[model samples]
Target: MLVWERPEPPDRPVPAPLSRERIVQAAIRLADADGLDAVSLRKVAAELDVGPMRLYGYLATKEELLDLMVDAVHAEIRPTGDGWREVLLSLAETTRRAAHRHEWLADLLGGRPQLGPNTLTGGEAVLAAMGDVDLDVVVPAVSAVAAYVIGAVRREITERRAERESGMDQRQWQVTHGPYLLRLFATGRFPALAAVVHDGPHLDADQTFRTGLDFLLDGIGARISP
Candidate 1:
């Protein structure tokens, strides 16, 4: 029989009561303030005033930490409504507001499959709202809603960021660029463009988003019972 001595664990002093939630929160703050690139194990540890290795105990890698952060925000989405349409609408609004508050969220929206407990809870809410729909159709219906939410929110966030950085709102952007586009129309090669640009009503971002949502929901409503 061979005998070997067991090695002792590291003898460093105890870390400040670390937890996965706490670690994720710290990372979120960094992301919120400085964007997602600013979040790193080293940076998170520095924010928490502990060694990086301490975070390793809670999250195995940066990807795991990011996943936790994404789910943490998903927990903020609270959908309340009487039926599937209302529920999906509420869900879309909640997700949009969350993304508005945390623009970095747009960076990861729909980038990966969300599998955390909080993310699962949000999905469960969508499923419950779906009521007695056929199981086969339920997932597809939910997925369509989710796709619309993510795609629309991502575009909204991106345009918002561009507006902020350019010091111009969407309306201002159209005003500044609309004339140039109109010039091309004047050349007589694009009568359709000229007609639309000349006659179309200028829509604010909210109107555009809401109208698009209604249109999408109208299509989805056709498939469901109610």
Candidate 2:
């Protein structure tokens, strides 16, 4: 059973009683600082100054702890806006920002359906804002937006991490690698690509994401009923 579904143990009178929240928070701190690989039951227990075995009473496995951590982050995604599109846009933007804040989130977003309270609450808000559309139509619409958000957020985070590690922004990287690409373009093998690279608008990451999301919403709007 999921940790949330399990009954909470009664509070003990010990100097520092172990709880699921404390354990998950400690693990998140570790992950936020050193990435997910740094987080383990043993390490979390040690962070709390307890033995590893003490954690098993609160969590069954490391996977359960991860689920809790992900859900905890989802709590940060608050949906707002007057209409369905606005609400979805807000959801996408906030989720993207959250993933950026917690870079490790890119590794786990959309990997599975999260049924934690916060996730379910967010979904409830979205669905409520979507009005009374049929499940057949509404489900796909929401799913499409979700898929786009997940893919875009993951790609953005990956690129951001790459830039950070390589010590070069996108323009610098392009300039540094321009020679090889320019040669390929000059060969007339990628005339269409060359034209875009030479003439296309250079949008920052935020602009790119917003434009893509607007395009997605426009496409979905055309397909769904008024």
Candidate 3:
């Protein structure tokens, strides 16, 4: 009779129900709104009207959350079946654009490469694009091309962020810095750079990405065939 009351259920709090997909989507939204640094189990839980501990049901740790967020962004870039070269170029540019849009994406490493689905997907796409070429040459060649594209994109995104933060859009930078650049070039110390950057042209990232990809592939072909 003394034990029949069930101890009033111990007055425990009810844990908020959560799912992997839901948590991932919420984290994506959080990242989209406030960049990668804003996303955490506690932060997401506050947004989701739950406690931080609840996130463990879906994501084990903060690192896991970061991995999911990056992959989610990667999932947005769809590959159209053109040729291998075209597809790879498109993928490269697409990745660049996405990283540009979400500034934090360029820096998300997820500790290890394999844990991140998007990173793996992108790597696979590069391999697939080079599938037509000799594996030995094509693999290294595409790797170099991908590295260039990523480096360029990272630089571009960083510059863009700086411009946005400083209230100097591309137009303003060109208007203000164009003269100084020309003046410096007129000094002859940086003749080649000055000529390339004369009057400051905006880079067409898409065209640049494709052209570089082709150049690397051509080199690979030459090495393989010769």
Each model's C-alpha lDDT? Answer: 0.81, 0.88, 0.69
Report the Cα lDDT for residue 60, model 2: 92
Model 2 sits at a Cα RMSD from the real structure of 1.5
Q: Name the candidate that leads on TM-score.
A: 2
Tell me the tens digit of each residue's lDDT in model 3 across 1-226.
1211112222224565566656788887888777878888988888878888766655567876776777778776655455565666666668777876777877762235543456567667666765567677766766666677667777776887788789998789889988988788789999779767765654575666666667876775578678
Highest lDDT: which candidate? Answer: 2
Question: In model 1, where is the ten-residue run with the lowest total lDDT?
Answer: 1-10
Model 1 global lDDT (CA atoms, 0 to 1)? 0.81
Better of 2 and 3 by lDDT: 2
How many residue pairs clash in all the candidates, one count each? Answer: 0, 0, 0
Least accurate 10 contiguous residues by lDDT in model 2: 7-16
What shift in Å separates residue 193 of candidate 1 from its native position after superposition? 2.2
Cand. 2 TM to true fold: 0.94
Instruction: Supply candidate 3's per-residue lDDT for 142.
Output: 63
lDDT, candidate 2, equals 0.88
> All predictions: root-mean-square deviation over Cα?
5.9, 1.5, 8.2
lDDT of 1 by residue, 76-164 (tens): 99888998889888888899899988889988888878787777888888889888878777787777777888888888888877888
Ranking 1 against 2 by lDDT, winner: 2
